[model samples]
Target: MVSYEGINNARPKTWATAADEWHALAKYSLDAAKDLREYGAKPLKDNWTDEVGATAAAEFAKLADQLEAAYDILLSVNMVADGMTTTIETAHSTMRAAVDLATQYGLEIGVDGTVTGPPPRSRTEAEEMGPYRAQVQDLVDQAVEQVTAADRLAAAEFAELAGQTGLTDPGKALNDLQTHASHVQMQMLANDIPVDEDPTTVRQWWNGLTDRQRKDMMLAQPVALANLDGIPADVRRELRGNGKYDRVKVVEYALANWDKGDPTDFGNNCTNFVSNALLHAGMKEKTSIWGTSDDDSWMIGNRTGVDGVDKRLAYSDSWAAAENNQNFMLEHGGSEVPRSDVKPGDII
Candidate 1:
């Protein structure tokens, strides 16, 4: 006789704060690993004995073990939460179906399908109610199994990760796994699905992103790839929509229309144009990074560099002095204009 409101109010027991705590702990453990590595790397002339190094190693190992345990617990909690969410969803659907059937047939059925009025005394009568009773029981059983499996899977993944910690670079491996988990959690959140505590489910979610999204996600590649020669496929897709790009055509266009003397229209032109373009591309006032020096002054709060308009003006003056009047001629001419009319190399 559970009320719909009560069922609707039900939530997973796992706390996001707890997950954050575990993640923090993992980060600390990673720092400890780095400390251990630095300690071990000290000059041989320091004359470190086997016993001392062994003791330090043992302590680090113990910390790693504790970290692994915490990670496992985190995964388990997430799995249970996921299971609870799934169970609730299934139960709601089942209840809705049952209510619909009852409305259609004009009969009330208990969750266990026991008739309220007139208990069936004879075996023949009980036999007649078997199908309905079985159907309800099956639904309940399925829900229970799913929840239980989620709990078990979470526990298993935690144990496996813990066992591997000692043999592998625990910090690096776990951090990678954590990144993967975060991506999975993001996807689940995006879809309005609850992230389960189970590592398996998290892993599955990580493996399920669209190829483009997956490539674009920072977690998918190492930071070292940032300065690589070619752009990532995901980045190219985002920039050009399709992969077909005429590099020669783009280069030729830029060179043919390049304005060498104008300071505002040269390199600064791209930044100004991009800033405005980004605003027009649906970025709001907060997100948009463009405007005049007063409206969008990049130097409003921070003075790490010179103030915005002043900085540009200073540069223009310096360039004009360096180029011996060539800059002023271009500035007075049609080189500088609004962003829309400017090509790739036009000054702002």
Candidate 2:
């Protein structure tokens, strides 16, 4: 089972000190080897002017180069491990702060991941603390998620590092790490991540990212361009909607006018709102029983006749009710979509 006890008990400073010593030793050793090759081996070989001496010097120089390279790789690995330790230590402190806040609220988490509480003394206090408790709960949830991510990252990186490289070449180690990171990023981009994330949660996370990061992800992970289950439909619509209609304008109009009635249906305004939205979206009036007075057109206007003129601007009952609107959409250029498959700008 996953636990935060390691974070709570981490002695990162101690590990950091060890890393520093190791890094210094590696660098010092590399410098010493270089010095020995340049000052002792090379000079001695040059003064000898013998084939055996030259061959021995050349071999010593090759050994020195390998030694330097090995030390360089060692230092690189030590530096990375040191940085990771420090970062995780900081993360641990942050999580501890969250736990402190939870303690202040008399909250206790069981091993099974259930939270128990010192119940509020009274209903009034409970009521007052409800919103605050909700906020705290969200904070704790986010903290837990971040901790889990950190654990996974640290473990996976170390495992990959161990398997992929030896200290023979520092540059190769660095290159392999970068290549692996890029491959993992691409895999994440193509995966159905949004389908797994909560729509509100994903939207909030997206909003929190920097603009450059957002652009980078969008370019790198185009698969997320599809409105998945985890992203809010409205958010998707804003990002990917066609410019043929001002969706915001129409939706706002519907919200503002849903209570208002029309001449045809003075008591009901469902279809009127839908029709108004369609009109604002640039849908044109149709002929052949497709008007306010006709049986088909998605219109809303008038109904009475004035002398020789018919008040054709009114809406008909068949075009002003919810069921009628539903049928109209079904018969038109629209199809019924399941809630899971629905995106923004789609008619319900």
- Would you list the C-alpha lDDT of every candidate in the order shown? 0.40, 0.55
CA lDDT, candidate 1, residue 227:
24
Among all windows of ten consecutive residues in candidate 2, which has the lowest summed lDDT? 185-194
Query: Candidate 2, TM-score vs. the true structure?
Result: 0.43
Clashes of each: 11, 6
lDDT of 2 by residue, 1-348 (tens): 235555555566886787788688778868876886998678868796688778778767766665665565556556545544544453444455445555777676554334556688999988876654544444335434444554455467557655643344545644665445444434433331333445554554454444544554444443354445545465456644465454554555555666665434434455566666767666665545555556676654544644123323555544557787787777776678788655434566
- For residues 117-191, could you state the per-residue lDDT of candidate 1 as single tens digits? 246789897777655454434333333443344434445555655555444444554466444444443333223
Q: Cα lDDT of model 1 overall?
A: 0.40
Q: Where is model 1 more than 4 Å wrong at Cα?
A: 1-10, 13-28, 31-89, 109-141, 148-348
lDDT of 1 at 198: 36
